[model samples]
Target chain A: MVAVATPPRGAKRKAKAPTAFGGYWRRNQLKLAPWLFLAPGAFFFALYVVAPILQSFQISLYEWDGLGTREYVGLRNYEELWWDDAFWTALRNNVVWLVLYLLAIPGGLFIALFLNQTVRGIRIYKSLFFFPFVISQVVVGLVFAWFYDPTFGLFNEILGVFGLGPVAVLGDPDYVTYGIIAAGLWPQTAYCMILYLTGLNAVDPEQIEAGRLDGAKGWRMLWYVVLPQLRPATFIAFVVTIIGALRSFDLVSVMTAGGPFGESRVLAYYMFEVALSEYGFRMGYGAAIAVVLFAIMMIYIAFFLTKMYRDEKGV
Target chain B: MPSITKTRLLAFAAATMLAGAAMPAIAQDEPLTGELRIFLDTSNPAPRAAMEGMIARFQEMHPDLDIETTIIDREAYKTQLRNFLSANAPDVATWHAGNRMAPYVEAGLLEDVSDLWDEEVSRDLASTKGSMTIDGKQWGVPYTYYQWGVYYREDLFEQYGIAEPATWDEFKAACQTLLDNDVKCVSIGTKFLWTAAGWFDYVNLRTNGYEFHMDLTAGRVPWTDERVRQTFANWRELIDMGAYIDNHTSYSWQEALPFMVQGDAAMYLMGNFVVAPLREAGLTDDQIGFFQFPSIDADLPMAEEAPTDTFHIPAQAQNKEAARAFLRYVVDAENQSIINAELGQLPVNSQATIEDDEFLNAGFEMLSSAQGLSQFFDRDAPAEMAKAGMEGFQEFMVRPDNLDAILERLERVRQRVY
Candidate 1:
């Protein structure tokens, strides 16, 4: 959007003795203004984000309690993580979150397609579907925790109708991660639905009409015609869902605090539990976990960036 | 120089008089001036009022001192402690005793208040002196503490024809009877992890005795040691019997209370703090009773869990003189009695009178006679070890079959932490 025009070299010399400083500023302001505008963001990005990442790398090499003098223990933390079962559990849960969380994409698309209609109460239905995303995640976690309560939860009550169980989903290690993931997927599905609903509004109607003329109906119509049109929306949904899955901390914190014996812990929550929680001040170990988590995130982020760059180049 | 000696002499006389009477004529000889900042974590309404009232009384004693008090949320205070201790330390700050203060002490954040723990103070507060001591120096002074035991519904025990069990077999029989009556034996919540640690502490203390438990926490003994395994075996009896409320991992300590309150569960092995909520939940003295966790080995001297809350001067404090004076005021037997009476806890000072309340008196009696007082599992163990140990306890409670795996995991963590 830069509209700044360069003055002709000859016209610059012919201009009536513009002050030396003013002339220099006029020449360089276009080149420098963008950098000037970017300074605050770059400064903060370095200070808050980049600096901490680098510091975490440094801190990961030491044995420090976040209080005492640092004792350099190079690579020991990571070596310990190799044998650490809790670390592996957290990493495994993150993978489970990544895989199960992707269900939100198709789940959202289905809801979006169902809701894309001319109906009297469609708006009300749409808002109702969007309600979960609007509330704080803490509230969502609390609601779902109560919903899964063994003795009084709705899940058990439904199970009781068939004489199944008053099983404690959060108390069972095998089910704890899945239970938290289900809680996470609720808001996430709502989020993706909103994205797809907006995408549906921008869909080209003529393409659908052409598909209909060719006898492309139902699943075939969605597959051959409408799906390509929603690629951008799907891309956005995938991006958010994957990142959301990776940084799944709040729900786990609120629901169980990595209970059922740390079964529900994601890397993010485990890192905090190790670093800042009352029972943990193992700064070096926590930093090692953070660095591993960062490395995992960087892989996805780098891939996304490269894909975005290629798309921008129309490749 | 002579005037300084006179001030010291006057302070010593005041301290001696405090040992005999209610309140010392404090700060009388040498008035403390400048600002004295006190940070407290007693954010709950009653303890907050008790502390503020105590500080107000201290302010009255030193009217010239500009006393500033900042009360932080109890949980938030824990993580924020390191930050403030290093960055913007107050003259004095409240903290817990035992290894909870170890990190701060090792980091040189806390002032060594060995001088404050004088001959008289040492003898008077001797019970908690070990908890406050680190590396042969006293880092702080404990103000209040409370006992941990099985708090049961008296009516339910009476209904089942059960007396307070004083032996392992009796405790098990009591649990079995309660279970046959369609009642859970104990209502524990391991959601926060420390509640399970409470059970571990008692079992270990009763199983192998206090010294072994302390050594195990200190990393001198391995987690997979036979003694440690025996402690787990004892705990497994309760778990295998399904004595605890169902789905306990889903509930907080407070959330587990309703089981006992509603008589769905017969007892709760918790700290004396549970008494307040029990009383508030409409349970009367007739309905509730306190008993020591029964002896697993009659040969072992009885040791009890009593987490002590303490105050320390930050090493970086600008007003160390005023802070030391404030600490003396805090541990004065009469002041401790007043504060703990309001707090519904036991005063650390030996001469301090227990509150007339049934629970407080029971806690006081139980603690006073106990051979050793543990600072709970979480406090006794190092921070990282405590987390791993407590998690293992929670796991063992849910899946008793996983005991071997859990002990191995804790052994690995214990190796790393130490």
Candidate 2:
């Protein structure tokens, strides 16, 4: 901003003058300032995120084995994906994940409401409730896996008390994906709870008090006054939970590795299994799978961005 | 390919001359240099300790050479090799033998190590050569492998007055007798589909002999072939008898061991690597005993499942010489003996011998005398086909009545994958 204000230092040589540096700096400084600030983040974003995405699209068109010469097979990889049963299973599982994952929002709000009251040891209770979110997803998956174990797990043990036989939740293809998603929900619900709790704290007590004066309390007060104020938090919660569902990789990976005949597969895990695993590296095929996942994420991202844009314009 | 072969041969000959002029210990004269990065999965404590010991010894030998090792969880390790091997490839990596290595070999990720095999491995390690060879060339050097057979609870058998079956009829009858007395006849964990493949390999190899099994695994034969159907038919009979531990699919191979250990179930058809876990589960040597998988189709030659592990230099590695040195050092019978001793597994090198433990003796005998050794099903078949085949196998185990449907589905996968 001050490049124009500073005079050139007493010129020693005419051509070697400081005018060039200052002139360029002054003329472009404002225009370049924001970009200069964004450079590091933009550079990384382009390098890691953008480049790999374009590369994945490119790789999907070829029969490349990660190494060696790539054969340009055009849409053959995508063509194969059309008939791929595992792809369908994974896609269906992802849809199920998305639909079920939204439960976290209401679930979180309910939890936040339950713990929102001024009770003794509430802070401790909040932290304890948010404990699952604090732990890594890998650990949560393992813990849940142990809980769901057929012979020795607590779930089965609990069932035994009811004179019910053990349930092989992880091993049965019918229940495997749901079993993993339930585990995913444990942590996800915790995360949404934290978001709602903070959102709840920022809620206007005056509006709540006004609502209470009109006989609004419990669910009605929360719906009419409290929730509207928590819109930003709800929006963030929805976005993250959707992403968590789509990126439902770790839980499936840690708990199942897409087992029981690929019944538990999400697109991400299926891609890994196809391109890597003990299977031959059909990188092109894997890339095709990734491209499909990216396409899906793009739809969500587009929807999210458009919704946010409209909200921003309105506000 | 010829042009590459010529250039590689020249480089290899130059390397050999350098080796000859150097000290007998390759690294001592060359003062080994460059990074020798090895990615392996040794999540099992014994094997992990054995690998660490091996690497420590390797470091002591080539103190000047920088070494990097990444040991990953076994399952995760399976998913990352293709990624790393393609980009910033490591100098050395561990891989399985048989059709499992075919994709990497075909994609040229693994260096052709036939020269190293001839110079160091082929003579003493002939038994393992078949597993490592692809298109008449060796892809890697196998260091360790163990036998797969019936691991039974001897105490349970004795208590129930059941004799160890040696023939197919006796095996079936034994399952019937055990079921009549309320004991699950077999304990298997098919949670990781490959464990189901273990059962498939034994049944296929026993019913159809090793050649047909290999053909089937190689995708040369259709899954609906009469022989394959017959194998499943036999498997169905066992399934119908409720011979296997219930809900086998819900447990990993390790998870299934508890039933056998607790004497609630009697037998496990598993690789000998499970010995460690079984012992960890508190079953003593006397309580746990092994028998060869019972013979079926008496005219068919006997074969055993022995999946071997190998080390290979990636084709793009910068440290070929150092990696070659590692391969040579690792395949040496003495080193193999030391490593496998700690691993509680048998070394692939012929001259490498295990101590006189009863199980080891039985395992060695079982593998050695077999007419052919089939790498367990997952290792024998291309990963894609193996995966589909095993899934079908597992599904069939659950619903034996779906035999035709399962075979048809497997045929579709085999057609596409092969």
Candidate 3:
């Protein structure tokens, strides 16, 4: 639609006097307010998170029992990791976890779309779908372990219904990693679904109606209009999914404990096994692994932050 | 000159007051008055109850002293103890006796109990005096020492017409018989991974002798040595014969215990602690039997794994004298007997009378007859070496084809450490 145009040059120009205090307040207050609000949180963040990161990095360079004189080994720990097969296995597992975990975003979005309707007792269905996320990871590990049990597990029972022999989901090296990942995805998918559900509620109805009038329906509608609107939610979902995958420690710790010959070990569990568990007190070596893991996580964090910066600048 | 004279007079008065206070401090060596905090393992109910009783007796004996004991699970105990000792250390905490104490000892975290051990308890437990001694000094006093070996089901053996194996050949034969009968001969859980290393150490000790076992763990002997290969060869034979439980890596020690308890498996090579759970699962004393791991070579010097649990006084202990007194009371025959009765462990003190408990008596008898006592694998070896070594053992057990690769990797780890 076109509107009538007005002449550009001779329209009345209005000039307002600048307030005397405007520059002073703008120069000083603008700078002061953001930092004042950030100070307490930033202090805590520096104390708890940032400081420990630096300390862990420092500790990784030395060989020390939790106590006793720390010997500076320079890069010996990192050097050893170059040939450490277990460390490589752990790193490979983490990559697999990262790649597989991204599936949760789409899976969660699908579930959220399915449950976004305002039917009777939809709230109950939503809560039921969200139930697994509320339970402790420890409990989730135990439940999945039982489910994967070859002898009397529900999974084996289901297999029996098809006249197939029971598969050792947790016991076999070929399947243990997949078994643990499945357990991780249970709650992760639920968490992502909740995020998408909220995002769907905030979707613009007018945009959807316009798309419908334009024959953008089903997959076409989802791809063109709906998903663009869900970008913020998807970004959050992807960020959290990546973090959850990288930090997949608890289920692995409780379920298989990086066993079936340590075939299931991710970096987090392997780091713990090295540092703390009966494995040994190789704190320096463990910290080296932790640093490597932190470096990998930093790449993804930087990418996400850059995207967010661009989006904010556009706003 | 007048200010100097006044300062001299004040110094004289202060010295007089200090001397007065020192006299009372020496005179009232009465029992320490304040709370004595103890951190102990709470996984098992019996020992916690027994400890509470002992604490009550200590409280009654010295009305001025109060004891606050916190019992945590074994895993949590390690984490909490490490944290506590690093920060607000307790007066006395339970710990393992060997290399586990070495780190704390080096850090000056443990109180030097050399004087106490020399004057009081050393005479009572002369046989175990060496166990508590580290370097040139005694760091702590062990209350109980437990032997590790195979515990088998008598009923399963009887059902399969298998006799208790007295030698390596007989052991293999018995394992074959069990396998033929569709029963697994060994039930092992490698989820913790250290349990598998226990078998490795025992096999190595039996195959090569105590000195070589020590040398290998100490990183002196190459892991690919012929003697080490022989141990793996024997282990490979057992695996080939389908002797161990299927999918051991998926199971914890507790989970594998059921196989033995349910008669699905014939034997469990574990520490004496497994007896409590075995008995709890409704297996009678008659249904189970304990044996030293059968000898691989009859001429080898036999070394049984006998890890000891001890309590040490922290250097930061507020009441050092009272802590010493409490340690003394714990090792005394009367208290040792009570502890052993409840704890199902052999007493560290030889003079402490053995009770009627069958398991403890068997453990005591076995320890007494053993040619030598070797600390458990994880305890005897440095922490780094033990982790690599145990993982190697697990890998070898699962896939015999990987033995050479595993041992080579372990050798590389050992070389790097040295």
Candidate 4:
């Protein structure tokens, strides 16, 4: 002290101490701060969302009618699925749905690129393109149904102008699923287009200039420069499109109801039909179907999570 | 320095807490009041409107009680009803009778309305009490009972020189006559699976007696029995003779009504509800007429499908007394008349006057004179069996080539249920 503490090497001067409560908060903030902010939301999420999911999982193993003693059926529900051809057909259709629904991405990107411009009335065109997404899927399904009506629908009427015979799009089993998928893609494509337009606005002009100097233009420019920058947008678009495809219930229900002899059934509609429809209340069996679907979804989710983890680590 | 101000703040907080503690007591001394909730399946406009009118009247009667009602479509009704019942059930709700009510009844979710039925419903009427009674105890009070049979166009029948067939052979001949006349013999909408179930029940019931039909539905009879085989054989005969419409799976019952109304189809096997749409299509009562389903066996008695609509009070209902009072009031002759007048349904109460509406009168007559009444196929059969049986019927109708496989699959389903 007499020697002025010798001004020890790399030593700093002491600052004023914080208050007791503030000091405690600062010391533990990394651990406690997150919980403090998340407490209310976590409480609600646990009560309404997480709890019900767990409850559903528990209910899946028991034979219950939403009441009475829930008899534990173990794997019998899954065993029944072994021979359930309809379940297989529905699963196959869902696979088809997941594959075909990806077309919405490119289709949406193309539309987005086409509409992303400074042309006159471009805003109105964008708004018009977004109209279908704003309307309820139920209404869209009804409109599409009327449009596909063989006898008097607008599509057939247009065909009639070209001297082609009427085609029963909904009535033909082979074409019914495609018809429903087309209707779904209408709104899905609109959604994707909006996403891409936003992604395009955030593109780095400097990077584009560098690419141009490097002789990158047209498809080459898009592939190496524009698309890499649009990764976040494409990621979000892919996730939403996958979820939408997996949950394609409304259009199928409204337009065909998995009908034409159950040819249009996908997993979501088929599960509801088996579980709660007038047909039967096979809750356990329905749960088995749901679990299978969840497992398939989990595979995609794992892949997505791995990619996100690598990106987060700055790989 | 701030200690004095802190004391003043504490005093203010204590005063506010005391006021909050006293507020509930002051309000409780005023009145007893709360909300009453009801849910209904609103597929048809007439019944929905009639129900709304009834609810409005109820609200007017009980001004202090706030009533909330939720009307859902037919497809969503089952899922929503199950959820509501499990979580927070309504005071009263509309549900189908027979096997459809069995699961809920078995779970003890539905309140026992036997006391109300016995005290309020007049037993003088034959059909009123019978439809709602299950296991010698009443679980619900039926408001309407409808008859199911062949609704044919008299103009088409007359033009084709065919009369209403009394037997299966005659019915086939009538179909042949209609086909020869270039009119579709029967218009069916199998797209809604329940429509095809009507044909299955008619054939099965006509071939077998009511008791046998019940046994078959209750999983007591093997589906491989000769009676079952014979029913399919009879159905096969009709299919081979081209007795039904082309592309039946593509149409709904409402869509098919036009074919019958326009005389493009000779017959439509459906419930009495078809009259509503027929009238909407500008068909007069004389143009559309009803006939009992033709008998498949000469020896067995004819039993027609008569599905009933009933209301049940939930077991956990807080307003049980009020719900019972409402039930008693609605089943009374005055309310029955209002219901029948608006809904064009047959009144369960025999004393209720049939409106001058010709369709209602015909439905009343058909329901009153039927030898026996069986609940519709889907209602009479357990839910699982009904689904398989109905799908098999649809498949057979579309591809008669798969009759054996269809029958075998049905037998397997029937066996599983037993």
Q: Top model by lDDT, which number?
A: 1
Better by DockQ, candidate 4 or 2: 2
Tell me the tens digit of each residue's lDDT in model 4 across A236-299.
9999999999989999899888877677899889888888776657777777778888878888
Model 3 chain A: lowest-lDDT 10 consecutive positions = A8-17
Clash pairs for candidate 2: none
Q: How many residue pairs collide in each prediction?
A: 0, 0, 0, 0
User: Native contacts recovered, in order, as a fraction for each?
Assistant: 0.92, 0.77, 0.62, 0.46
- Predictions in order: lDDT: 0.89, 0.85, 0.83, 0.79
- For TM-score, candidate 1 versus 4, the one ahead is 1
Measured over the true interface residues after superposition, the C-alpha RMSD of each candidate is: 1.3, 2.0, 2.1, 2.2
Q: Tens digit of lDDT per residue, candidate 2, span A122-206? A: 9999999999999999999999999998878999999999999688898887888889989999989999999999998899888
**Decoy 1 TM-score against native:** 0.90
Ranking by lDDT: 1, 2, 3, 4
Residue A181 lDDT, candidate 2, scale 0-100: 87
Name the best candidate (by DockQ).
Answer: 1
Candidate 2 wrong stretches, greater than 4 Å: A1-43, B1-40, B49-71, B83-92, B117-121, B315-326, B329-342, B352-354
Candidate 2 yields a Cα-based lDDT of 0.85
The predicted structure with the larger DockQ, 2 or 3, is: 2
DockQ of each: 0.60, 0.49, 0.39, 0.42
Model 4 chain B: worst 10 consecutive residues (lDDT sum): B23-32
